[model samples]
Target chain A: MIKLKILLNKLTPGDTLTFFATREQVDNTCAPFSSNGYQVAWDQEAENRYLVRISK
Target chain B: MEDSANYSSTFFFCTPLSHERIIWCTECIASGAGITPEQGRIFTVFLTGDALFSFVDATSRESWNALSKVPSVQIVADGDELRLHGLCVSVARAAPGICITERGGGTLFWEQLISHLAAEWKGTKKAAFLLCHPPYMSRIPVHMLRFLSGAYAAGLSPELYAYLDGLHNIHNGQRPSEFENIGRAIATLARKSGESGKDPWFAACSRCATARGYFQMNPGTGYCEPASSIDEITIRPLKEILSRFPGFYPILSHTSGGIVNPDRSRDQDTRPRLIIFITNPPYGTEWTFGGLSLALATAMEGIPTTVVFIEHGVYSLYGTHEVPPNDKVFNVQEMVAATLDIPSLCYLVHAPSLERRGIGVEEHLIGIREVQNNDLAQILWDHDYSATRILFF
Candidate 1:
C-alpha cells in the first residue's frame, strides 16, 4: 500500500485535482477512498490528472 | 478616417475553410480597391469553427490552393500577392484570434478586416483600413476587438506593437473615435485568426500601450509605465464607508482638463449630489475612462473623490470600505446594475484600471450598493450608480 499526501488549501467541492500514478495501482487506491464516500470525477489518461469530489 | 487611407492599409482575410468560402474572400477584395480576383487569387486556410479565405497573387495562390483540402488552415495575404499563404490552423489561435475565427457567430468581422488591411498594405505613410462585414450588425465585443488587433499583428510583416500604436493614436485626444475604430478592427481580426496573442485581451491593452506612466499589477515585479508619462493616482472607494461622513464631497476629474465638483456645502443637506463623468479618450495608451472620463473632470473641484475602475467583466472601488475576503475579486457589471437606481447623492468617479487583468476591491466599492429585497428605486438607483462608471481599461 502506497500513501500520497494531499494539499487542501483552496480545495472546494467542485474543484478538480491533478496527480501522477501508475495505471495498475489506480483501482486499488481508489477503492478505499470511494468506499469512504469520496467520488472520483475524472481520470485523465494522458496526463494522469484526477478530479475528485469530497463530501461536504 | 479618410477613404484614400484605405489603399495603404494592409489587409488580412481569415476564414475557416481553406478554399470553400470563396464568396467571403471576394467580398474582402471588393471592399478594398486594390483586390481584384483576376489580379487577386483566393487562398483558403482551414481553422476552427469555419474557413479562413485570403486573396493574394499567383505564386501564393498556388500555395494556398494546395492546402485547401487540409483541416485547420489559417491564411495570410500580402499586398502584392493575389493568393493567400496557408499556415497551421492552431498557430496563434485563441482569444487573440477570436475576431478571425468566430466570424460565423457575427462578432465584429468588418472592423478586423480593415485592421488587417491597415497592417498589410504599404505606402509612403500609414493608411487606414475599412473593416466590412456581411452588413446589418449592431455591437461587437471589446474582447473580440482586442483579439483581432493582436491577430493582425501576428500575421503582418512589420512588428505588430508599432502598428497597433499608430492605429490607436492616443496622443491627440483623450477620447478619440479611433478607439472605437480600433476596437471594431480588433474584434474583426480575432474572428479571422484563431490565435489569441500574448494574452486574451492583449490587443485591447495594446491600444493604450503607448500611454506614458507605469501600471503595475503585482507591485514588486516592477511596473508597466511607458516613457510618455501621465498623472498617476491611487483609486479608493468612498461611498460605502464615507457616505456617513458629513461635509464629504466627492470629485471626478478628466483628461480634458476639467473638474467635476458637486456642492455639498449646504447645511442639513439631505440630497446627495451625484456627478457622473462621461467622455471618450484617444485609442493609444493613456488610461482614460471610455465615457466616464468627462464625468470625473466635471466633479473634480471642491469635492472629495472616490475612483472606480471598470473594464471587461472586472470592477474595483477606491476610497474607504471594509476589507473584502479577496482584494482582487469584483464584478463591475453587477455593481453598475446596482448603482444606477439609488437616489443617494451619487458621484461617479471614472478612471481606467491600472492593471490589465482582474478587478480590485476599490473599483467594486464605488460601483456597487446593497439594496433591501423589494425596493424598485433602490435597485434602479444602484444600477444607475454603477452604469455611470465607464469602462476603458
Candidate 2:
C-alpha cells in the first residue's frame, strides 16, 4: 500500500481527509487527537479497502 | 405538560467538527441575532465527508421520538439537555480520552456517537439497503453502543470489528459486543413493542434465548437463567450487571482497545510471556499462595513471566507499612526478587489502580513496568496466542 507521513504542525483539528487516486487508491482517514500518529484516538478500517478516517 | 420555563434547556449542537462547528455559536454572537437555518432554531452538525450513522439520546420519550424522525442535520428546539448525537470526533486529537463524566449539550464522548452519512462505500446493494430507513432508536444503550458508536463516530467502519475492547472482562467472558447485542435486543423489542425491560440488561441471562448457554461459564454450569421480571427486554451496562451479581465472570480477553495483541509472533520464539493477573490482595494467609505459587511455578519452569497487578491486586506489589514480617507468606518480596532475577521474568502494575490504592511505583520492589489500564488486553492477548498459559489469582 502507498504510505505517506503527515506533519502534525500542518494539520488542523476537525479536519477530515480522504486519500483517493494514490497507487493504493485506499481512503486514509484520521481525526481527533493526532499525537503526530502517536496516540490514535480514531482509526476505523472499513470493510471496503479504505481505512475509514478524516481526510482533508 | 407544557411549561415555558422547560423550553429553555441546554440544546447540544452535536456535529462531527466540535472545534470548527463552535464557530457557528461565534457567528450567533457576531450577528447579535439568532441566525436560523432552514429548520429554524436548529443545531447544525457538519458532516465529515461520507458518514454512515447518527442517533439521538434524550431524557424524555417524546423528545426521543421527535428527534428520531428528524432527517435533517439540525435538531429543532426540544426540552432541557437535548443532546445532538452526532459522531463528534477528531482523529489525532491530543486529548487524553474524552471526559466521561461531562454531560451537557454539545458535549459527549466519542464512543457515544454512530455514523449516518454513508456516501462513499454505498456501492454494494446490501450497504445501500441498510443505509435507507436507518433504524432511529428511541433509547440509546450507553455500554452496548460505546465501541461501535465510538468506532463510527471516529469515522471507522464498525462492521470490520464487532467488538468492544474492555467490556468483556466483566461478562463471564462474553465480549462487550455480545452484551451490547442483548441491550440492542431489548432496545429493538422495546421499539417494536411498547414494553421494555428497565433493569440491568439481564440477571442470569442464557447466552441465547431459544438455545441455552450462548455464553458458557463452567463445564457443567454453563447456562444463565433469566431473571423473573415482567418486561420483554431490559437494558443495563455489562459492568453494572457484573457488580449487581458478583458471581462468575467470562474469561475476558484484552486488546488495548482496537490495537491487537502484539505477542502472536512470539509463538516461534523460545520463551512465552506468562501473564499473572492478580485481583485479590495478599491476606497473609494461604489465599495469597495460590497466585504466588502459580507465579513461582511458571518462573521456575523458565517461562518469561509478566505479573500484572489490577484492582486490589495492586496490593500485590505494595511495600510493607510496618517493620519486616516473620511470616512465610510475606516471602512475596523474596520470591518476586528471585523470579525477577531470571533474565526473562518481569512485572507490570496498572497505574490507575496503583494510584487509586495510593501505592507509588518506588514504594514497591525495583524494576516493574507501570502501564495504563488500556494495556491489559494487549499484554494478555499477546500471550493468549503463544505457548504461555495465563493463571489468575
Candidate 3:
C-alpha cells in the first residue's frame, strides 16, 4: 500500500518503523519492502498477530 | 526556480490519469515540489497502456485545459502506437502536450525513458522483474517478455527472478504449440545480455524448483541439484533474491493474473509487506498451491511473511499427504512441511474454521498456530497499519 510509502517519505535511511499485521497481510505485503533493500523482521505476537519491524 | 531548473521527467505506464487525479498528480509534480511554471520548469508526462481512452473522456477536457495553461508542462503519449492499434485517440490540444503522431511515436516514449535511465545510470540501465507463472498460464509472461525485449533493445539490462510456478518457465524440453516459447525466449534474452556485455542475472527460487521437481536432492551430498533447466537459468536459494539487487529499485512482479506494481515512492523504508490467506485445500484449484509458492518465495526473500489458513483454507493444514507411487502429483502437504522451517515464514490456522469443519488441532501437522475468530479479527485490524496488504487464495 502507498501508506507505507507516505510514511517512508517522512523518514531517512537508518530509520526503523514497526507495525502489527495479520499473517495474511504480512505474507502479501512484505516482499516488496524486503526486496527494495529494507531490513524486514517479524515474530508472532499472538495467535494471529505479528509485529513487523522494518529498517531502511 | 528557473523554468530550466524546473524541468522534471516522470514516467508513467499502464493507464493514464483520469480527470479526478490529474490535477493532484500534476500539482504535486509541478508546483508542490517548490517549482512553478513561472520559474520555467518543463514537466513531461509519458503515459502508455490504454491511455488512449483519456482523450475521449469528457471530464478530462477540463483538466487538460487547466494543465495546458502551465506553459512549461509537456504531455506526451504513445499516440502513434495507440492509433495504429485502431485506438484512434488524440490529445485535446496541440499546444500543452504534443501527441507523438509520427511513425516513430510509439517507440519515442520508451526511448526517452531509456535515455533518462541511462543518463542516471551512467552505465548500463537495469530493470529487474519477478515472474510468477508458467509458460501458458496466461499472457502475463508474454507481456513480460515483450517489455523486457523493448528494454533490452534500448540497451538497458533486464533482470528476472522466477518464483513460484514461474520456475516452470525455465524447465528444459518445454514444447508449446503455436505460441512463443517462453523458456527459449528467456534463454535467448540471457544470451543477448552476455553478448551486449551486460551482466545477466536470471535466477529461480531453489525451494520452488525443488517442490516442482526441477531440483532434486543428491544422495551423495544431501544437497539439492538442479535436475534440468534451460541454459542461463540459475537455481539459487530463495534468500539470494534479497541480496541479488542491492538498494531499492523497482522490481515489477508479474503473475498470471496481472502485475503487482510496487509503490512508486523512492523510499525503501515505506515499502509494503505481503500476506497471503490460503482459504482452500490443494488439488481443487491452483490458488492454494500458488499462494504457498508465493509465501515461501517472499519469506525466503527475507520479507516478513505469513500464510494463514482460514475458512476452508484450514483444510490445507490438516492431515499428512501421500502421493501415489509413480504418479505425477504435487504433494501439497510436503510442500507445507518443507516451508515449516523457513525463517520469516509463519503458518496459522483459524480455530473457528477447524471447529466448524469438525477438525481438531491434533489432526493437523505440528507448528501451525490455531487462532480463535476474535483473535483473527483483531489480527486483521492490527495489520491495518500503514500499507500492509492481505490477499485471499
Candidate 4:
C-alpha cells in the first residue's frame, strides 16, 4: 500500500516499478497516466507480482 | 495525501532505494474484474541501472478476460502502450555480481565485494546490483545456489571470489577396480556367515575415482542406490534440488553478454569435459540434433559433460516441444531425458531467458536446472581452463 504519486516523483522516464497487485488494481493504477501520455508496459513476476514499466 | 489523479506521467521501470519499495499509479479505460477506473501501478525489479518490463498478470487469469487474449508483450520505452497484451516478462540487463563459493563465508565475501566495487567504481555513478552466494547457509546445501543464482539474474554480474566443489578431496581417485577390490575384500569376511554379500555399487566408475564413499537416493523413487561414480553422489541431489526449483539454475547464470565469445579460445580442464552450449530451437533441428548427438557420445567416455541452453534454446526443455519430422536425431528430447540418468551429465538454462519468453520451469522436462546467465562465465572459469576449446552449437 503506497502512494503512486510519490513513485512518479522519483522516477525519470524509463524507470520501472515492480510489485504484486491484482489485475483490477493494476488497471486502476495505470488508468490515470495511460489516459495522458505516459508510456507503460506490464509484466508478471513470481508469486503473482506484476511488473509495470513506465517511460513517460 | 495527494490525489492519485494529480500525477501526470506513467512509465515502465524504476529503481527503488535499498530497504524500500516504490510505486507509480495512473488511470486507463480497460475493463476487467473488480476494475476501478482501469488503474495501473509500476513496481521495482532487476536490471542494470534500472529495469523495464511489461505484463498483464502474465498468468492465465480467468477474470482478466481482456488481458488473457494477448498472452505476451514487452513495454520498454516511453510512448509505448500495449498494442496487444495478456502477459510478459522482460530481460533486464546484468548487474554487478560476486560469489563466495566454497572457501570463505558469506560475510567475508560481501564485505570484500562491496569494498572492491567501491574501489573499482570510485568515480562512476553505477549502482550496486550485486549477486551474492557466500559459502554459508541457513538451509544448508539446498537454497544457497538458488539465492546466489537468482540474485545474479536480478542484476549482479561479477565474480568476486574463487569457489571449489571440493569433490576432488572427497574422493581419492579410486577407480572402479579399486572399489571392486575393496568390496571383494569385504565380501570375503561375509563368507564366514555363510551368506553372500551383494557387490557394493561403484566398483569401477570414474566418478568414484576420487571418492572416499559416495551414495545417493533416487528422487523419483525413494530407493537408495549405489552412486554410479563419485561425482554422481554430488550431482544427484544437486539436480533434484534444481528440479524442485528449476528456474534457479537459469536465473543465477544465464545471459547474452555472459557467454564466452565463440571467436575466443575456450578454457581448458586438466580433465577435459564435453561442454555443449545449445543455442537454437527444434525448428533449427540440424544444430540441435548435432549438439545432442555429440553430448551423448561424450557422456559415454565417462567425461564430465554438460549442456547449456541460451536464448530460445531454453524452450527446448518444454514438455510440449516436439521433434520436427525428418529429424536426423529422432526423439532428441527423449535422448536428453535419458542422459539425465548419468550423474556426470549436467543441464543448465537461464531463468530470465525463459521468463523473457513467458516460459516457466514446471513447463520444462524434469532433471534440468536453470542458472543465471552470468553464471556461464563462472562455469567456464571454474570448469574450463585457459587455452581450451569448448564446443558451441
lDDT of 2 at B170: 22
Worst 10 residues of 2 chain B by lDDT: B125-134
Let me know the DockQ for model 2: 0.01
Candidate 4 backbone clash number: 82
lDDT of each: 0.27, 0.32, 0.60, 0.34
Q: What share of the true interface contacts does candidate 2 keep?
A: 0.00
What lDDT tens digits, residue by residue, belong to model 4 across residues B289-313?
Answer: 5556445434533456678775667
TM-score, candidate 3, is 0.47
Per-prediction DockQ, in order? 0.01, 0.01, 0.03, 0.01
TM for every model, in the order presented, reads 0.18, 0.28, 0.47, 0.28
Better of 3 and 4 by TM-score: 3
What TM-score does candidate 1 get on C-alpha atoms? 0.18
Stretches of candidate 1 exceeding 4 Å from the true structure: A1-56, B1-56, B71-105, B108-174, B177-393
User: Which is the winner by lDDT between candidate 3 and candidate 4?
Assistant: 3
Better of 2 and 3 by TM-score: 3
